[model samples]
Target: MSVIFTRRSVRSYLPKPVEDDKIERILRAGFQAPSAHNKQPWEFLLVSDREDLKAIAGMSPWAGMVEKAPLAIACCADTERSKFDDSEGAWWVQDLSAATENILLQIEEEGLGGVWLGWYPDMERVKIFSARFALPSHIVPVSMIALGYPAHPHRPADRYDASRVHYGRWGVSWEESRSGA
Candidate 1:
C-alpha cells in the first residue's frame, strides 16, 4: 500500500545512470504480473544507447523525458503468443497493462522514478517505434517507460473517492451501505 500511494509519474530526471541490477529487478517484477490463460506475451526492449533513446523520445509527443533519462524500456506484446479469435487480441492489452503497472510499482521500490508513455492503439506511434527498433512482425510495441533518478520531487495524488464506490448492488452507494451495516 505504501508503494502504491507513493508511486507517481516522474517526467524530470537527473543525469544519472540506473544500476543494472535494479533494472533487472523491475523487469522481473513485470513478468510476475498475471495474464489471461497464464499466457505471458510481454517482451521488453531495454534501451540504454543515448542516440536510440533520443530518437525514441522524439517518436512520441508525450515521451520527451526519454531523451534525458538514462534508460528506457519498450514494452512489447507478442501477438503470436497471445490468444486471438474473431475479435482482435484484446487480452494482450490487459496483460501488458498489468505488466506495466508492476514495472512502475517496482521502480518506486527501487527508489527510482519512471513514467509510462502510452503507444498501443495509436497505429502511427506504434509503427514509428516498431520501425525505429527494427522489431519483428510478431512483436507489437505497446508502451515505453523512461526511467532514472528524479530531478524533481513528486507527491502521490489522492485519487480515492468513496462516492464512486458502490456496495452490494449497483445503485447502493457506500454511504447507504455503511448505514445499513
Candidate 2:
C-alpha cells in the first residue's frame, strides 16, 4: 500500500546517478512478473550516457527526462519467445507491460522515481534503437523508463473516477450501491 500510494510517474529527476545495486533489484522485480508459459521474454537495456539519452529524448515527447535522469531502462521483448504453440506468436506486449509495472513499483520501493515512456508504436525509433543497440532481429523494443532520485515530492495519485463507474447498464449509477450508508 505504501508503494501504491507513493508510486508516481516522475518526469524530472536529480542529476545524480542511481546505485548499481538498485538497478539489479529493479531488474529482478521486472523479471519476477509472470509470463505466459513462463516465457519471460523481456530484456533490459540500461542507458546512463548523456549523449545517447539526448538522442532518445528527441524521439519521444514525454522522454525529455531521459536527458536529465541518471539512468534509463529499455524494456524490450524477445518476440520470438512469445510463441506458445511451438510455431507462432502470442501476446508478448501484455507480458512486457506486466514486467514494466513491476519495475515501476520496485522503483518507488527503492526510493527512486520513474516514468514509463511509450515507444512500441513508433517504428522509426525502434529502427534507430535496433541499430544502435545491435539488437537481434527477433527482439522488439517496447518502452523506455527514466530512473533517478526525484527532485520533487510526488503526491498520491487518485486513479478514481466516480462517474465512470456504472452499476449495471451504461447510464446506471453506482452511487445507489453505496446508499443506506
Candidate 3:
C-alpha cells in the first residue's frame, strides 16, 4: 500500500544506472499482471543504448525524460497473442495497461523513480518506434517507461475523493449508501 500511495510520475532521474536484478524483478512483476481470457499478450522491449534512448525522446513530445533515464522498457502488445479476432481483439490494450501498472509499482518498490510515457494510439509515435526497433506488424507498442534513481524527492499525494465514488448506482454517494437511503 505504501508503494501504491508513494508511486508518482518521476521525470527527473539521477545518472546512476538501474541494477540488472531490479530490472528482472520489474519485468517479472509486469508478467504477473492479469489479462482477459488469460491471453497475456504483453512483450517488453528494453532500451538502454544512449543513442537509441535519445532517438526515442525525439519520437514523442512528452518523452524527453527517456534521453536521461538509465533504462526504458517499451511495454508492447503482441496482437497475435490476443484471444479474440473481431472487435474484441482490442482487449490487448487493457492487458498491456495492467502490465504497465504492475511494472510501475515494481519500480517504486525497487526504490527507483519512473514515468509511464504514452505511446500507443499515437500512430506517428507508434510507427516511428516500430520502424526504429524493427517490430513486427502484430507487435504494438503500448507504453514506454523511463526509469532510474531519483534526482529529486517527491511527496505522495492523497487523492482519495469520496465524491467521485458512487455506491450502488450513479449519483448515489458513499454517505447515502452507508445510511441506506
Candidate 4:
C-alpha cells in the first residue's frame, strides 16, 4: 500500500544504470497483471542503447525523458493473443494498461524512478516505433516506461476524492448511501 500511495511519475533520473535483477523483477510484475479472459497479450521490448533511447525520445514530445533514463521498456500487445477479433475488440488495451501500471508500481517498490509514455492510438508514433524496433504486424506498442535512479526525490500527493466516488448509483454519494437517504 505504501508503494501504491508513494508512486509518482518520475521524469528526471540519474546517469547510473539500473541493475539487471531489478529489471527482471519489474518485468515479472508486469507478467503478473490480470488479463481479460486470461488472455495475456503483453510483450516487452527493452531499449538501453543511448542512440535508440534518443530516437525514442524524438518519437513523442512527452517522451524527452527517455533520452536521459538508463532503461526504457516498450510494453506491447500481441494482437494474435487477443480475446476477440473485431473493431470493438480492444480489451488488449486494458490488459496492457494493467500490466503497465503493475510495472510502474514495481519500479517504485524497487526504489527507482519511472514514467509511462503513451504510444498506442497515435498512429505516427506507433508506426515510427514499430519500424525502429522492427516489430511484427501483430505486435502493437502500448506504452513505454523510462526508468532509472531518481535525480531527485518525489513526494506523493493524496489524490483521494470522496465526491468522485459513488455508492450504488452514479448520483448517490457514499455519505448519502450510508445514511439511507
Provide the TM-score for each candidate, comma-separated: 0.94, 0.89, 0.96, 0.95
> Compared with the true structure, what per-residue lDDT tens digits does model 2 show for residues 75-144?
9999878878764654778889999999999999999899998878688888888888898988988989
lDDT of each: 0.90, 0.87, 0.94, 0.95
| Native-to-model Cα distance after best TM-score fit, residue 146 in candidate 3, in Å | 0.3
Ranking by TM-score: 3, 4, 1, 2
- Off-target runs (Cα >4 Å) in candidate 2 are 86-90, 166-175, 178-181
C-alpha positional error of residue 26 in candidate 2 after TM-score superposition, expressed in Å: 0.9
lDDT digits (tens) for residues 11-107 of candidate 1: 9888999998999999999999999888899999999999999998898788898988999998999988996555564788899999999999999
lDDT of 4: 0.95
lDDT of candidate 4 over 56-132, digit per residue (tens): 99999999999999999999999888856444578899999999999999999999999999999898999999999
**What residue pairs clash in candidate 2, if any at all?**
none
| Model 1 CA lDDT for position 132 | 83
Clashes of each: 0, 0, 0, 0
